[model samples]
Target: MLDIDEFTPGTGSYEWHLSGDRLLWSKGLLAVYGLTQAPDRGEGFFTSVHPEDRARIRQEMAEVCAKADRFEHRFRIVRPDGRLRFVLDRGVVVRDATGAAVKLSGVETDVTDVVDASTFPAGQGAAPAARGDGRMEEADVIDALFNDAPVGIGIWDRDLRFVKINPLLAEMNGLAPEVHIGKTPKELLPEVVDIDGVTSLLQEILNSGVAKRDVEISGCTPARPSERRFWKEHFFPIRSAGRVSGLAAIVEDVTEARKAQETIDALLHELNHRSKNLVSLILAISRQTARSRPDDFLPVFQSRLESMSAAQDLLVRRSWQDIELEALVRSQLPHFAELIGARIILRGAPDVVIPASAAQSLALAFHELTTNAVKYGALSNEAGKLTIAWQVSADGTGLQIVWRERGGPAVLPPSRKGFGSTLTGAMLQSTLSGEIEADYSSEGLTWSVKFPLNP
Candidate 1:
């Protein structure tokens, strides 16, 4: 095998083990991030990446691991001094005997200077001045970055006329680079964008020689008039010979990111509403339990709480979406989990899913039925048989459930209604907006419920 220890100036190697979640970096690799040592175990090394690029990098790496062995990526990093640098990353995933990805090893190289030189190109008028060591002059460095930074870049003279703009900015503005020259923001941009605020800020920067970072602008672009776009901009004065001559800006499009954050906000709002509803439910259940069984409060209440918690766990596991009927039944009847289809019969449409709003009520009802069977019905003896089944109505919009017991001690009507019976009957009916019926006879107990399946 070829030696993989090769190292060069401005380049570093790294390896990570998926099993241990461990990352090891060569000294040169640590130096690339201005660190003298490896990060603390799993220390979020991605934090060094620019925030805007972090998610994309992680997603790309994941896709790479899933679909291919080799990968190449370029992204920006912020060093200890808070300066930005561009790096090229290339890596390979190591697979084990079972075709499982076991490790990842990679090399990274600082490519900022080379990319800058390429952006400046060979024939962009006069040659840029150079230092004694042949390094590029500061002016040329600025010119290069203004021409080809990843974000939109542009310069406007004191007269507020566009003097220069990079291709990315030109595309964002829905105009060609040459068309932007000698034009004011208002003249080139769509009226819908109404760039007066941006123009005023540019004027302020030009006059005061002050910089403004993270200034936000939102409107529709001519290229996409229907969808509103957002951008975060940085504006700073361009100075020559100790005098402010123009204003320059870099703009980053954040339209997708803005939409994503808005979605997260909406989800959080929904979660808060659901949490309040859950607390109210617990309070109501507590009050009813205390009134119904004051003497045996702890045991009764605790069992009921466990039943609700099992349903909640399923709901959470499914991200609050529909819960499968079979899964809910199994969870609510924990004592018979391993005995399904043997002594405890279960029949239902495997595809039927219970709406989240009705899941808890149904779960509680199942729990009560099972508990009662164990005490005075089929589950009380060896010869007992329990059949729990459900089916969708002919219209497919309603559900019917049955709990039947046989072959054990016969059950009789209680002297009076209890909390457990209420949970399986009236409470379930009211919660699901449906009908329930219970029959106690010499053979056994048969309880049935009908409800609309939609929430």
Candidate 2:
């Protein structure tokens, strides 16, 4: 019997005396089988063999003993604790002078971790062993690696028929592994696969022996039949005896990544557009302010620019989607909090969403109104009061805002139009495509603004 202590952990040796059906198992083999004590005879080992593989292993052992030939087999064993483990058994038979088998000696190595790490599909046989050359063959390694890889992998013959497909690739196509075998891409995925083009590509790779990398393919797959998906695929020529035989492909899903890149591109374009618009707006404002108030242009221009900056800050916070009218008004009146609930009355539907362009225009218009009110209008006197109200049109297509002042000094129309009046009237109209009506009666000031909801 081979010395049990000489064998490494996870490995064991065994000797079966053929004539007497006697067996000697190393301590390692006992541990490998989850046994507390050695079995009585060589046949006891068969009892631990998985039922599905018992007959085949027994027959192979019998033949090896009778013929005194070398034996190599990979099979699963059932431990006493009901745990199944894969193992490789290899040995040679010893015979007497008459060539009748005397003993069978072999080494059994645990291969459970190797097989599990491979993640071969269920029912796929145990891992293959190295051949006599002591090096694992490329074909065997490729087979194992292909099936166990996380990414989708497949092989197509020169005829464009699926020669083999891994479980991952089969799942991506929403088919079973067996269903993909011997089927062309067009036949299996008529709606998704570009049959002619893919077939031509595979043929080209096989004939030219050239590899194609990072080719993006986009189409609706059965897994997500309604929405189109993107995949990054690389095709390599499978060679046999130094000649190209078929084409192999590895694929990765890139739908989310691609969509994310596209969204970033759109945001960059939008940013550039808004930047151009802002530059043009500043140029116009500079020209208007210079012509209107050349003597005191700096102060007026700085105030207006500050108001625009505030409006832009609000827009940035909301991703420039839309601003609520109430929020816009509150943000623009931060310094007039005391008048908001006391001298000033605000009334409106709370759900109004102001368009981006209209928001900026309204912000500037509100700044002018509030400035005037603080200086000489409703908020200037102890008894002065102001009411602002807004409502959507009955058809829901337009919004109307009204501002009325009371209990203030008698109002009179300005002798000449100034920046405030010009901005509130013409600038607001052009910016928001709205109509404004203002009355400066002796009693007070009244203003009305009407605009399309979309604008």
Task: Tell me the spans in candidate 2 whose CA falls farther than 4 Å from its real position.
Answer: 1-126, 129-148
TM-score for candidate 1, residues paired by index = 0.63
lDDT of 2 by residue, 1-455 (tens): 67644334556678888788888888787777888777778668879877766667777777777775766666788897889887767677889999998998776766554333233222333434357878876548776798799899987756666655777988888876645544578877877657578777778887899999998887886787888888899999876556776678999988999999999999999999988988887787789889878998998788778888888998999999888888888776788778787888889988888888787778878888877877788878898898888999999999999989989888988888877887789989988788999999778899989999885
- Deviation (Å) of 228 in candidate 2: 1.6
> Could you give the C-alpha RMSD of every candidate to the true structure, in order shown?
19.5, 15.4
10 residues in a row with least lDDT, candidate 1:
120-129
Write one digit per residue (lDDT tens) for candidate 1, span 308-418: 999999999999999899999999888777778888998888998889989888988998888888888998998899898899999999999899999989678888888
- TM-score of each candidate? 0.63, 0.69
